[model samples]
Target: MPNRLRRAVAGLIAAVLLTASATTATTANAAPSSGFDNWSCKPSAAHPNPLVLLHGLGGNGPGNYSFLGPFLAAKGYCAFTLAYGQATPAIPVGGTVSIAQSSAEIQAFVQQVRQATGAAKVDIVGHSEGGFQSIYGPKVRGYAGQVGKVVALAPPTHGTEFGGLVSVGDYLGLRPLVDQVLQQFGCPACDELIVGGAAVAKLTTGPIAQPGVAYTVIASRFDALVTPHETSFIREPGVTNKYVQDTCPLDPVGHVGLAFDPTVAQLVANALDPAHASRVVCAFGPPL
Candidate 1:
């Protein structure tokens, strides 16, 4: 890379890191979302398995699922959330570490949830990075048997170009430099999310959906982060993929808002319990 370009990229990375650090500092102490982490709540007969809610990159368990967690719990499901993949004590936001490490944390949490609820399996509702881990934990991290259903919202199952910045970097052969800079700042997962990065390549090597595990992928056309949005869908035989606009044409929800969107919560409810599925009620607004 040219010296000038290198300097520019370094400045951009530093700005992003500083912004992330500021955001985490502000929201790190936020309380857990309502209706989650209820260790004493057991799975009922209708909802046979407890539900695990996973948050996205740069998000904590409480802030991400503030709406969805309570919605599911009100529907008679035992929903739980955890803050995983904390890259450093200084940054309390989750999903900043490598996917492998985060998936291992998920495995341990799943065991704890199963033991607490006495259920054979648990269902997953993940958003963004959490959505990727929903499948990664089962396919790569050996949590398949413990997971029954997975509902992914706005997940970059394939990968993202970060609004074409990643492609630009790859073309300039600056990806390695970018990755190094991000890792030094304790955000290795940021590089791993780039299109054609090592982690995404590993996920694409084999079938994304595991057998005997029900999968549902929900995306939004308005999502700016996961460009083209269709990359969030799984083209497997049994997996169900949907777009929010398919039902609510003008909902205008974005990537981060998907977890807090009522329309998405309804979609998740139907995915988790198809036997009693109902029509989705759409509303217009940003995330709550």
Candidate 2:
């Protein structure tokens, strides 16, 4: 009986992970629009805080919210994305940007959105490294209470083994390339999302949560980059955690999929709107 139960549990867990990866295509995270290098747009009453979206390493904000921006605008949310990270002389972005550096960029962008929109706080959504910045970066810089809510789509809250793979790059004589690309971010040796020498762990267990900030983590069990599946969970109190595979049995959102997956996007829209809390099914499994 014990063996049978163990096997069943493992199988169920495997199924969820498989579902997570099947959520969407693994090509590259893309946005619906383009062209925002040193440009600015103002926000109106219907769309407040000038929604800020942060992309991961080597990413441009334009491609970050391709499908999402239009959908959000339709739903009355003023949307915006920013490009960050060290740019190479010949390389175009929408690529890799260090986590710590991008976090600061998020803070500055939030300030800009606030100044433009006249809102005290704004909504922040991040992908990959942007996820860390939205959730933990600003608060670490002493701006915790200023954020109204943080929504992370498949954020590596607990970090990942695949990321650990990249931490080894600098040690193998690619140090100059690493330093030139990363020095702009001023990343310290212990930055978790950077070198993987405890940046993720230190950040995770250190203080992933802050008071007065509404937190929600949207994750997929099929994430190829962040594994063990559960790492995407935000374990802090008062945080509303959502697992797409469990919520929508047919949702085809993996790690990158969650960014544009319509179902997941619908869920994201609901979370951003506090009045519609009942629209979300917060149970562990689909209702019987």
Q: Which is the leading candidate under TM-score?
A: 1
Q: lDDT of each structure?
A: 0.75, 0.58
What TM-score would you give candidate 1 relative to the actual structure? Answer: 0.80
Instruction: Tell me the tens digit of each residue's lDDT in model 2 across 120-187.
Output: 87778876666766876655676876777788876667766565322212211234555565656444
Model 1 clash pairs are none
**What's model 2's TM-score?**
0.69
Root-mean-square deviation of every model: 8.7, 10.0
Task: Flag regions of model 1 displaced more than 4 Å.
Answer: 1-35, 163-184, 285-288
